[model samples]
Target: MKNKIFFLSCFILLSLTSFSQSISSSPYSLYGVGSLYDSDFGAIPSMGSSGIALTPSNFINNLNPASLGFMPLNHFMLDVGGKAIATTYQSSSKSEKRNNFQFSHFAFAFPVTKKSGFSVSLRPYSSASYKISDLKLPILDSNESYYLTAGGTGGLNNFDFSYGYRFTDKFTLGISTALLFGNVDDNRTFTILNSITNIHKKTDYNGFRATIGSQYKIDSTFTIGTTIKLPTQIKSSKVQTVETVADEVLSVIESNTPSDVDDYYMPLEIGVGISKKFKKALTVNFDYQKSLWNDTRQSDLYGDFVNQDRFALGFAYLDEKSNFRKYWDRIQYFAGANFDTGYLEIDGKRVNNASVSVGINLPIENSLSSLNISYSYGQKGRISEGLIKENYHKLSLNLSLDGIWFVKRKIE
Candidate 1:
């Protein structure tokens, strides 16, 4: 079991190092640093990404790191997963479709003591991939027209570490530190009378991020959790190049060496959640999250970064009285839904998004391992606001493993 865990870890690290590129292709990603990546993993994805207040059990909950303090002593857990996405974009008169597949998340957690724990993980911070070429304008007072084309790719990555300590059987606190780094590439081209000019820009990012979390048990059946992510800026360098195109041939006309740009701002975020258990047969969770983007004083060229909020409700159920001999009877079923007022303000309206999800956990034959699968259908933006609308379907898979890391052995 240990060997298998080690192998999986190495494979994920190698894959991440070898394939570094954008994982999404939505036009909404063109704003700010790009569309933000989901921060939850494991069965939580099936549960509307809302497990912040749940006590740790077979799976590790990273949504609220403080929950780690409840892990069983000497227990080690690991989760690795990925997702596949298909999306269709629609405007007032046209539509396009795109597909993508990419690694989702990787994490490892271990208990330091009966009341303390630690964990580490690697997850995507954001993604940027888009192409636009539908603009045409008549040359001033001339019978000629020009076209504008724009596209971008690349994103940011986050490496995080967390530690949690239990103050009592009912309360826990945790802190997390993250190293953020990545790069983004943006390009634009203008064409007129068979002549084309292109401008390309690249930005490299590096920064540190921090967060704090806490959880308090209100009763045997209810618990409350909260988290706060502090605002920080990412130091970056930008490189620009200009090229001229004629007769299908291109030549670089000018270029700017990479130079430092004013650091980009990241907004503060806060989240709160609650979990309720009903006699072990069913559990329900509710979560609310907010990003204070309006206070960041940052604005995109085409839109404003406004305050963002999300609400989610989740449920899990199992037949506790079912025979253990039946594999299907022992399985857990989960379902959820979420709604969001997105961070981008375009055409005087904030982009809105919503999704519904369902999933199940399949237990391994003779090991403390389970395979989790989830599916979600979502939509973003509205066609009535002079904006593009996006509809997407996503599939996610995760392998959750539990084992003992070390113990004393006795021999005769």
Candidate 2:
């Protein structure tokens, strides 16, 4: 237990200090806080990211904070994960490919009392990383063609703390507070072909959020859960610069000069889910989620923001007894599918996404901990109406440590 505690502390420090690169390249990320992070902290992501209604007997359930109350007494859980993404973008004229590796999330959960628990987590809520450049016709009356370039980097990070209380044997309630903060750097540049004129612009962002969740057990095998994330506004500031370089001399019009900008609004979200566990081996779950972007009455400069909805279904298989004779029996298998009606609307068309996922949880030798690995393939957007299409493959890996802590030991 002491060793596990030390390891958890080390991992938390590492996550805070490590400079992991961005894992996304979708142009759609330009709409919101970048592409929203879909995966949670543990094996739940492997099971189609649907575990709101399921209890956390073996892993962390950051989806529904209310499930935290279901943790066993004296049991502490820690999860650390990362992901890799490979994406191909296609248009009517050309295609390009991009790949990235990034840290996913880290979390810790433990029981506070016999009927209560709490958890703390650090994860990226969204990411924006894209670069697009093209040649444009001469601006205004200028005969020289200029290069048009637009790109953005940076995203929001969520530091969340939650507490869950069991109201009854069958019901639990929880609340979460999240501190959201980040810098969004949007860069748009125009450069003349034969002149030393370059213009650039950028924008930065900061925010806060909260959520409530509940879970009800219908029976030994069935459970239902719900969650709501409150909306908030992100304060933003902008800056514009113009630079000229000629004959080994450089001149700048503005450098890091702050400009006035309107606040960005994040949409409210609601989700409901159900889960059924059969005979302690097979578990199935389904979820429906919606983001109320329309209510925020906000729109991006590049696209219109509309309501977003998602549906997912998944299942997992676990062996209660590791049948030492058959290693396969000790491995857990998971698979699921999801469909999303995206929030970004362009040219009277809505961007959507569809994906399928599969994963396995393998028990570590001589321990209750497990190593989880999951893979997903998905497509986003359409190549019609001058819009680009994206196909992506993602791989995730996590280590979940479940162990007893703060208990008296019998020393020989």
Candidate 3:
């Protein structure tokens, strides 16, 4: 039975992987590598993406690797998730709507010993899919303006391996290593007066990064955790073609020219979180994270990089002593909220985001397997001159399944 389940899961995972490309369509994705993705696993999406101090005894926790230290003995776990998003883009002149389906993440974990665990996961790191048409911009140092049309596709993917060890009953430490790789293709058309120019480029990137985390239990009901993400540079190379049309005559300036480009720098990040339990029925989690984007000294053509701050809070409830005959009584309910002071600043205005989510976990049969469903409503950016605002509704579904290993069955 276990072998059948594993093979079935592998088949589904491959199917989803083929359709996971182009998960984002935000105009904001035109900047940097693209819009960063949130591929939180299991119930983490329902918890406002907050779970730094949580243990992975019930579900895998991607925010902090230390959570794996508490994995139940002799248990193997697998988690897969996906999302559907509907968004409305609003500007001063018009509004547009788009919908997308995203393959969120896939992971599996197992215990190495009584006090240690390890996991491996694969997920998208960013999305570079966007489209813009006839955007007018003033030419620098001139009274003239130009019309610009741009489109891009492709993004980065993250493959990570993590390990956690419990040194004592009250403390755990963990480490993670990630490989980031992908490519982006962009095409742009510029119209200045009667002259037209076109540029098409494809850039490839690859890099490695590391993270360290620690968790400590203050008491039976309280826990605290911290994590540090080291900065790294992504190596980049590009092939570009540039052409121009003058007096209705087309001329090629560069044809498939390959060259080295500036390497992209990822900023250092730090995070802290706390988890508290009230009796056995309710749990609360709060987390704060900071990214030093300004310190990286990275500048975009249309925006400035600034320090970023994020906060998340979540609540979960379940009835531990409810009647066993009532299925609803065994279900877990969750609610959460998140706020982010974005790292990109355009026209002296910061692009920010805020969101709230609610969800439930439904158990399957009598095993440690369940389905997680969540809904989120959020807003990003703001309506202003040359700015677009996004209002989105997202639905997430995650399946978590666990199987017992290395245990003898009494009857077989």
Candidate 4:
């Protein structure tokens, strides 16, 4: 109880010390919020990635309780998923970059109530990990040149807890909540073509999150589910920022006092899905979801104006003689497709994008564990009517461990 109180107190203290401010600044992009939470599940050609509203039969979604209804009885679930990426910039000769190990997430789940369960998970909310360096044309009014190199990593390390109850043999209700311990660390080097200054800032914000959803069996052959997510608020903090004036020299600004000003809101997300059983051993699932991104606002630095709406379809089948490992055979394959259009507008202009993803379940450790790998590639274009696009590729691998942990005793 004392430890609990201490952690809570620490969170509250951080909440009261941070404030968010965006002056016309390039490092401002560091303040850019929201894009890092996109979960593509690593399947690119079929189920489009990008946090679209869909759930395939995978282990990671349990971070939000809406995903727990899919687990089986006597089940103990464990998951670790990570990504590798190769990013290329096509417009500028100096734009090429690579981040082989980009992001990762971990999760665990187990039964708590009859036909009900609970779980916890942690994952990167939005990655501040990036580098930006560009030279501007001569300032018409000033004789100075602008060159800034800055980047940061970390945001909203989320911890989730959830409970799911079976209301009937065919229906289940799920409610899950999350507590985020956010830290965005940054370092910047600024220059006016000669003089340079380097500064760093680390800010922490703590907040609460929640999601409510339910699943129902339409018949012996099909099932469906939906969830409504509540918005999460990250307490304010004074993060490091740069302010550019007509003089062209970059400068760091701080609050006159320790101010609780920075606040981040993860918009409400709503989603629905359905699964059909084609045979005793074959089944298919499909889902659609929309996140309230338009309802969220951004600072000049957090440029992802695109909140997302997504769609997906996944399938599972039992293998020959059920020899694929009882657990591994339960998930034969998964495929999906997604579409994305963000809320980012450049003076009354908006651009749209889409993609596909696919993955397979490879059984491991006598079926007690399995390795699921997925790959995705996509493009979002029409940047501010300049037709700028970010064509990207991502590969992901997730390991799932599921089995029985305890057994109840009976007496005559």
**Mind sharing the TM-score for model 2?**
0.87
For residues 127-204, write the lDDT of model 3, one tens digit per residue.
Answer: 998999999988999999999999999999999999999999989999999999999999999999999999999999
The sequence of per-residue lDDT tens digits that candidate 2 reaches over residues 304-349 is 8899999989899885656755656778899988889988898788
Lowest lDDT 10-mer window, candidate 2?
Answer: 8-17
TM-score of every model? Answer: 0.89, 0.87, 0.95, 0.73
- For all candidates, what are the clash counts? 0, 0, 0, 35
Tens-digit lDDT track for model 1 on 1-412?
4356445645644554344353878787777777888847778889988887887577778788898898888889998777778999998888998887777778999999889999999989999888888566557798988887889988889999999899999999999999989888999888987899998889888999899999999888899999999999988889988899999998987787665566778889999999998977799999999999988998886789899999999999887778877877878999999999999997698898999999988776555567677898999998864478999998877778888767777774
Can you give the lDDT of residue 86 in candidate 2?
A: 89
Sort order, lDDT high to low = 3, 1, 2, 4
Best by lDDT: 3
lDDT of 2: 0.81
- Evaluated against the true structure, the overall lDDT of model 1 is 0.84
For model 1 the local lDDT of residue 382 reads 86
**In what order do the candidates fall by TM-score, top score first?**
3, 1, 2, 4
